[model samples]
Structure formats: C-alpha cells, structure tokens
Target: MRFLSPDFNFWIWLQHLDTPDNNLNIPFEFTEANMRQVKEILSHYPSNYKQSAVIALLDLAQQQHGGWLPVAAMNKIAQILGVPNIRVYEVATFYSMFNRQKVGKYHFLVCGTTPCMLRGARDIEQALLEHLKVKRNEVTKDALFSVGEMECMGCCVNAPMIAVADYTKGAEGFTYNYYEDLTPKRVVEIVEMLRRGETPPVGPQDSSRIRSGPSGGNTTLLSDPKPPPFRDLASC
Candidate 1:
C-alpha cells in the first residue's frame, strides 16, 4: 500500500523494515481448523504445483495472524507449501493487500482512482488522517486505526469510498466493510462509530442512496415499456 506522503519511497522503506514486536520471535503455525483449510486449498492444485497455492495460503496466513503477515508466518507458509522461503516472501511483499508489518484494529484503505478523486477522495482521506491523528499507514498510539491508499475498488458509482478491514474480532470475526458515497464528515462519523464498538451500516452512506443507485431516486424506467411483437411461423 502506498503511503500518503509525497516523499515516500517504497523501495527505500523496504530496506529498513519496522516490524511488530516479537514478530519473528514468536512461532507461527496454522490452527487445527486452519490446517484443515490448508489441505482444502492444496486440493485445488496438482500435487507437483503446490507452489500455485502460495497466494491463497498467504492470505489465509494473514487472516489467521490478525491481518498482517509476520516473518514467522511467511516462513510457516513456506513450510506448509514446501516452497523456498523466498517464494512466500516474494508473494507477500508484492501484493499490497498483504501487510508486512502490524496494522491497527481497523485499517482504512481509501480508493484514489479517478472517480473517487473527482468525488473528493483526497478530502476524505485527509479527514480520516486528521481525526485519527496519524499519517497514512501509521497506526494510532492506541493501535485502533491507520489509513492507506488503494486503487479502484469497483465502487466508483459511489465514489470517494473507504474499505475498512476490521481486525478487532480477529480471524473469525474479521470483516472487510466498504463505506461508499462518502464525505469528509460522513467518513469521520463512520470512524467514530467503529471507535465506539458500534457497527455502522455498510454500503452507500448517503441517506438518499440505496447501494449506488441514483442520488435522489431512479430517474429513468419510471413507466413500463410496450411489449415486443412476436412473429408467428404460421403467418410467414
């Protein structure tokens, strides 16, 4: 994920990693249930192509590890998949979705594509950063929130949206919720709701919208159209 800072250099930052406490010290292994899941994931691939399951396994590992992939977790995934450690590390680091370091309980990924940008995504992002008192990708002192940027999330119709990944409940309760049709103020309200342990309704936040519909209401197809004429073979 790209940070908000203009001077941010991902490559340079990659060289000097600031990881979570005991990230490498603690051993990581899938739970009994997750181990069963690993078998299921492997089932989809041919025996010799177990490496193909690297991405899926890494995602599972992230979920199991509470939203980030620790070094030990990546190592464990490599062992499970029987691939080189670099295989898993490469996949994990390449994907923006996989977090290398620890994130907060709630990680907000704001879409900054053309649609969202034209609809004031930057303002929404700034509002979140300001309210949380943290820079993009920086976790709050309380470890409750962090902000990051993402590409189009396919919710452009409801532009200026933020996808909040809630790790508060851990793997089972983990939820990736999208809040669409946002304003700076509305986004903050959603954050406040989350902070208070309240589950704000997901999807289009605007009162007038019903999940990306026209702002006020449907303006077209107000009346039924005439039925099409059917040609009979007998007449021909």
Candidate 2:
C-alpha cells in the first residue's frame, strides 16, 4: 500500500541550486488568482491564527498546480501563514491525499488493506500495473495513468474498490470516480475507457449489486414485515 518513497525534501534544497532543474521543472508559485483564494481561506481564521489555514491553503495550491505539492508552493504558503517552512512540510507529508511528486492525468488508487486484500485487491492492482505498464506510483510513459495503493476507503463491503482521480482539465475542477465490486478484467477495462478519453460508469460495476448491499439480490429483506400490535395506553 505504498508508492515510491518520495524524497520529501527535494524542494528544500532546490532554491540553493545554481541552475534550474530543467525548463519544465520551474519553481512552484501560487498564481494571483490562487493567492486570492488563499486570502479567503485565511479569512476564516483570526489575524493571529492564519496558520490554521495551512491545510486548506496547501490543498488549494496543489489543485492550482496540477495535483502535487511543490516546495515553492509550501514556502509561499508558509510565508503567507507566517509559519516556518518546515511546518508546511509537516502537514504536506502527513497527509497521503497530498502528492509530493507529479501524478498522471488519472491516478488509479487501489485499496490494499486487509479486507481488500482478502477480496483480491492484489490481483486488481496487478492488472492495473500491467495494463498501464508502470509499477506502483510510476506514471505511464504517456502520462495518462499512474497506479498507487491506498488504505481502506471505507468500502470494505465493496471489498475491492478503486478511487480513480482525474486531474485532466475540464468544465468542472477535479473529479473522483469510484468503481466498486470490481474484478481484474473490469479494472483493466476501466483504464482502457480513460485512455480513450471516455468517461466510465462510476459506482458498482456489477448491475446486480446495489451500493454495498448483498450482491445479486436482497435475500434477507425479501418479505415486508407486518406491524406489531400496539399495547393499550392504560397498561403503562
């Protein structure tokens, strides 16, 4: 349930380098528009409590710049919140939702917890890796997909479930789709749909399944229960 162990400190030293990492590796910074959002987030707290908005600001920064938290973004947030840069780093690293490195357009996060593992999460993950031709946390050559592991997503009944995160530009901001009750074959099909730039159906992949309810059909609740006779009020 882990990806490549990211350096977690790459950004701290980038500022001291004589030359830029590369043309595409530009320093991270919040845009003027994003700064306005940061101000709004900070406004939720008192002037003396700007640090309270650190988590919210970091999320905004990540959304504004693809799906990862760059060092420069954290530094900018630290300055605005009037806290040490390390504080921002702590929050970023503590949360798995915040990616330190860039992710592909679609991040296929499979649950690798006990319940999921018992249900075939490993096979699902292997299918994804093979279909995408990338190891865990590695982006595909085309940058279309990246595979990773996640803890239980509270969908244990759905045992093997995947949370597909889409960072591609669209009318709406980011969109997350969950496909539950999946098999290895179905998982690959889902990836193929994304590769074709098509939206796959979200939720349970099986038509017979309903949410996390009994698969196939409702066997226990087949008959409606009759109301019980009410006791006389005087008996009380």
Candidate 3:
C-alpha cells in the first residue's frame, strides 16, 4: 500500500472516454493455445471473481507481448475477464513494470535512486544517452534500445544497476539482465553489443572485479542475520 499511489478516479475517467462502437466488444489477438493458458491461470482462483486473476493474466499477456503490454492486449484481458477495459488500463498504468509503448529490443532501465546515483548511475545513464543517441523516455532511432530511469531495483549493493529488457531475446536466455557498477565506457560497450544483436553477459562486461567482493567488488550481501523475529526482544 505504501508504494501504490494511484489516482482513485480511474473508473470515472473511463466512462467518459468516447469509446469506439467496437471498443466494448473487442477481443484479444492471442493464439488459441495462449488463450487456453490464460484460462488455466484463472482456474487457480475460487469462482466467478475473475478479477483475482488479473495480475497473472496481465503478466502472461505481457510476456506474450515481449515485456510490454499493449492497449488492445489490455482490452482483451478486460474482455476475457469480464471486467471494464478501463480497469485493465488502470492496472497497466499503475504498475511501472508494465510497458505501455513498444519498448526497444532492450529496455535500458537505469536506476536513479540514492545508492545508484552515489555509485555513478548518472554517469552510466549519460553514457547511454550519448552512445545510443536517446534520452529518458525515448527509444533509439534503430528501435534497438530505450532509456528509462526507475527507482531502486534492489541492486543497492551493486548501486548503478541497469536492467536490460531486450525484447528481441524472447523467453529463454535472460528475462532480465542487471548491470552493476557501471561506467560510461561499460555502458557504451553493453549497448553496442546489444545493437549488434548480442547479449553481452549480465554484469560489468569489462575485466573489472567490481561486483566480485570487498576486495572492493560489486557483489555485497549481508553476512549476519538480524536474529529470528523477536529473539532479541528480551534484551530490549
């Protein structure tokens, strides 16, 4: 709840949108097998309240769409679930994870959060812009890349992390690639590899031992557990 800050008037706004005569009855352009898979996703829930399956359905649709969710695909979801199309749109827009516009072969998402910024994510972002000739919210001319600045992506240890969502690399090799301890040079190299239709392994493609360990590395994980639940409560 703390992270979900969506406007509450979405339903009201939907009713007012001038719908195309065929809008309400539109169907998803999915394959018969995919449709079956979607229905099965719903079978896990109890009964008619299909809205409960919206998340999984949308996610499946997104994967079907190669990481981005299309408006019509969203509409299809609404129709299949018997919910308002606007409702699906509402869900799509509220989640940053869903991409509305078509993303590049690789969605170059740079984290601009505190730790990343401190670690040089800005440098990496600037490098991406300069090297790829694109800016935040803009896709490359070649359509091979798109730049996006997002919040903490849980790579604080490897601050300056970027999640590559190369739509070209369909469902297998890597769903997501996190680049950590990035530099302008490193970022450029990664993009160049991507532009050439290659997935240059996940982290710093260079020879640096940045994430390796605190021999000054990029990988840092907490060593000690904070203690089981209230195990230390008595000490308080």
lDDT (CA) per prediction? 0.83, 0.78, 0.70
Which should have the higher TM-score, number 2 or number 3? 2
Residue-pair clashes per candidate, as listed?
A: 0, 0, 8
Candidate 3 TM-score to native: 0.73
lDDT of 2 by residue, 1-236 (tens): 23334542334222322224322256667778877777778779999988989889888887886776667778878888889989998888877777766678898888888888888898998899887787676678887888777788888888789998888872147887888899999999999888898999998888877756877777786788988999899989
Off by over 4 Å in 2: 1-26, 170-172, 216-236
lDDT of 3 by residue, 94-199 (tens): 7777776556768888887888888887788888878877656556787778877678998777667898876675534337788877778878888888777676
Off by over 4 Å in 3: 1-28, 171-174, 204-236
Model 2 is weakest, by summed lDDT over 10 consecutive residues, at: 13-22
What is candidate 1's CA lDDT for residue 36? Answer: 95
Q: Estimate each model's TM-score.
A: 0.80, 0.80, 0.73
The sequence of per-residue lDDT tens digits that candidate 1 reaches over residues 1-236 is 23335544334225425444535678998999999999999999999999999988888888888788878888898898888899888887678788876678899999988889988998999899899998777789999898877789999999978899998877678788999999999999999998999999998889888756777799899999889998898989
Model 2, residue 212: what's the lDDT? 68
Better of 1 and 3 by lDDT: 1
